[model samples]
Target: MTIHSSHPFLPPPEDRDPVRRLRGRLPAPVSVWTSSNGPIRGGWTISSMLVADGDPGELVALVNEDADWWDLFRKTRLACVNVLASRQSRVSEVFARVAPSPGGPFRTGEWVDSAYGPRLADAAAWVGVRLVDADPEHSGWGLLVRARIESVDLAEGRIALQHLGGHYS
Candidate 1:
């Protein structure tokens, strides 16, 4: 007799993970990570990432286990992090799957295939990385991908696109 759109097994907002709630309050930079396996290309908008400095700098990120970009990234073991500028939220929305694309997300913007992966044509800052390790992380329901920084291109400054409180800010 119950008619509703929400999944029965899905937890209510009040019952969700507290850790995730806390993390959501922390503003995270928004960027697009793109990868290609031969001719197959994919990109994803992401805000969960970190950088560790050492002999060889390492980039760490959490990715959805069931995304096209993740598939290409795993196969190629390479990616390019295109830091989205404040004025590029539309690009982010396209890659995030929150906005519709007539042809495809890639068609929304210009890109250049590089040794690392696909670079947003006008990305102010970008990083090329080679996969180092990937581990399963279930708490947030994502894979933890760690990569070594192979190349870095800084044109202007770090991007200002950010995500917080379950919204872009």
Candidate 2:
């Protein structure tokens, strides 16, 4: 699978480097990362995330430095990673800023307040995480954020959304 980077979600080749063709071959589950600074909340689509085995448990996620949610996440030092269902592509789009969503994106999904932040009620699963560290210097355009998993909520669901070849698979 080859993604030309001209793929709608990405910028043209000259303007933006092509996403690694191999990345399209490696399918990844779609998820939304949410953060709040008390009065305001924000979220965005994220595919660059993974869990790492450790004593206290941890997860790493790459967040675009330009995103407003990134700043909010830094201030809050907490977040919720919502593993999305296939039917929730629209939810993903809203956060990714691919489509317009009235009343803001949060209104499009059911939300529950959590110790770390907001959890997607209908997400396949969710993890509450507290920021452990952020390596901006080595992260390039995205901030490499490492977090300690504080909690997890699992729910029954089939058909999870996966990203592959520049499109949802």
Candidate 3:
């Protein structure tokens, strides 16, 4: 499949750049994509997470073609997207680390296995999703997964987090 980029000079329908068009109209929510199992058989993390649909609890996330968590996700077919609170920037930093490994974030941290999946002990809230389908085109990304939410846990706190642009406030 061809993912097009939006052209600024053209009209809405004429715009070919999907990311640019999307950026102009939508504000993406930040989420840490996570999975389980590695050399130590623990958890993992990814940076791309998006809600695919509302009904039937659907969501979409992109995993890099070469990431370790991609393999785990392929096997388990399950994952958790942890939504961090404002005070949880440290958690994001931990997950965002490029060294060590993808599971680096959970190296020394605590987590709980939930009906949805594994959730960070400190996350404000989290949703569990079971892989329904995956489409990996030519983007070199592992695959774009459409998942069904299995369950949700909403913890107490004001939601605030940062993404590609900056902090969400």
* TM-scores of all predicted structures: 0.83, 0.83, 0.66
Predictions in order: lDDT: 0.83, 0.82, 0.62
lDDT of 1 by residue, 8-79 (tens): 776888999889889988988888999987788899988889889986999888888887788778778899
lDDT of 3 by residue, 36-59 (tens): 654323244444566656778687
lDDT tens per residue, model 2, 24-84? 7788889998987676889989988788988789988777888878888878888998989
Worst 10 residues of 3 by lDDT: 38-47
Query: Roughly what TM-score does model 3 have, to 2 decimal places?
Result: 0.66
Candidate 1 lDDT at 29 equals 84
- For all predictions, the C-alpha RMSD in Å is 4.4, 4.7, 8.2
By lDDT rank, best first, the candidates go 1, 2, 3
For candidate 2, list the clashing residue pairs, or say none: none
Write down the worst ten-residue block by lDDT for model 2. Answer: 133-142
Q: Global CA lDDT of candidate 3, please?
A: 0.62
